[model samples]
Target: MDIFDIVGPIMVGPSSSHTAGAVRIGYIGGKLLGEPVKKAQILLYGSFLATGEGHGTKKAIVAGLLGMEPDDYRISDSFNIAKEKDMKIEFGEAKLNEGHPNSALLRLEGINGNKIEVLGQSIGGSRINIAQIDGIDTNFSGECPTLIVHNMDQPGHVSEVTSMLAHKSVNIATMQLYRSAKGGNAVMVVECDQQIPKEGIEWLKHVEGILKVTYFAGI
Candidate 1:
């Protein structure tokens, strides 16, 4: 294991999993939304709800939705900042059928009327896993630039996306696919070796069978 794994991340926190990792989770959720966050509904599960207040879990999540990093001093004052920005924030408990204890569910509403749902779990040492997106089960650590594509389940969609990425010279390090049923809603989750150009993402958005394309250029 790496030395950082034993030591932990540099952050403003009483607990790495609860505070620092929670911030990252919220930040990633905001990125998925792709616009200014106007409303956030956070659901704490298990350990996160048990000891979140003392660890600043809620505040850290707010800080992230506002685009602050883990070590941002502003995390302490995130509630006030959110109020000033006219953001609607709420907190609650969650029950999941499966996942880590330090898990959270974030429901975000953007100013553009866009909505996103994300399930994030903090494994340990400030590392996190994004377990689900928009109800699709996924497993990605957000350690690299990643692309999440929501598309129709149809022939040629996968090849079309892979071909496009290959043409753009973007290498896919790993990829996963999920679907609701046969010939139904499907998601393509790709972890790339390089940052995908904005043009490539835009091009994917316009693809015939593609419904939505979300890109996260690492944390």
Candidate 2:
């Protein structure tokens, strides 16, 4: 029960869920990719697939991928902007097995060949839930600096990550862990109160058993 929940977000929108939230989803997707988006494959689901066009959902997503925010007045002109920047974008519908009505899956490729897949949902009032990253189940609001680590499900991995964060003095606001199975792939979604230093991220990349690390400096 906050002001944003009641009044919604200040955005260029015909619908908060479709427009504003779509922008955020794209924004987060871009951040997770870690570089300028060179190509984007956007798949809409449920309500977003049914009525998103009329609500400017497509343009909003493209705008966010171009590094625009929800309140950016240029959202409506995102398609042209993307073309000008040589960003290739494709849109389609997604078949998700039981999820929120306003959901989208984005497959993004960066200029440097970095790629990421993100499944995000707009619950309401411009708030979002990033449900999956690179096919791993995740749960984070993207409201804080988030650290997502993909690693082998083994002993000491969790403690290693936590210890590093503690050493950096970054407080964790919330953390969730998910795994495919015992001794299989695992992911840690850690939302922190402070921005993690670039050196810390680089250090974590070299840790053994760590497969991938994605950090989102909060919007």
Candidate 3:
């Protein structure tokens, strides 16, 4: 067995499948939010809904949503942190069966009120499958320097986006594109071998036909 098979993962857990994985989901999703979470609705499905509280999944998730990384020692103190940070948190049962057994449907409103819905699953090691964003199917792994770009599905959109990245000397390590059909709506998910800077993000934001840009570094 390899290291992961042996050690499973470095995490806080009574059960990794339930606890550590939930924490990972929170941490990754928190980063995706781009700001502190002012309010959060965590919907646990099936097994998670049943045993989450006993497993400490709720506390783990709250910690993650507050921008606490997976390896942070402060996870156990998440409740106190939540009070200190003035974050509004709640838990409820969700009937979402469209994902893995350890899945959660998150409705998150950021501190600025810019909100989004994220459906994520913790497969193991706190590793997750970020399935959907705002009702669109996407393939984003919290790995590498990744870019989630939204835009109209026009012919030249991909070229334009990549061209800008090329100009900035960013090499694409992996890329995924999905849309309803040609020229309708689309999202380009790119994982880069190098860091994408603030200046590049500004350039991407100003690009014509670009709808939104979210960057996940060292994913």
TM-score of each: 0.96, 0.96, 0.89
TM-score of 3: 0.89
Off by over 4 Å in 1: 5-8
Model 2 lDDT tens row, 1-219 = 776668756799788889999999999999999899999999999999999989999999999999998999999999999999999999999879997899999999999999999999999888899999888888888999999999999999889889999999999899899999999999999999999999899999999999999999998
By how many angstroms RMSD does model 2 differ from the true structure?
A: 1.1
lDDT of 1 by residue, 1-219 (tens): 889767756799787888999899988889889898999999999989999999999999999899988889899899999999999999998878755889999999999999999999988877889999989899998889999999999998889889989999999999999998899999999999999989988988999989999999998
lDDT of 3 by residue, 71-111 (tens): 66888889899989898887887677466778787788888
lDDT of 2: 0.92
Better of 2 and 3 by lDDT: 2
TM-score of 2: 0.96
Q: What is the TM-score (0 to 1) of candidate 1?
A: 0.96
Clashes of 3: 3
Judged by lDDT, which candidate is best?
2
Pick the winner on TM-score between candidates 2 and 3.
Answer: 2
Q: By how many angstroms RMSD does model 3 differ from the true structure?
A: 2.2
Ranking by lDDT: 2, 1, 3
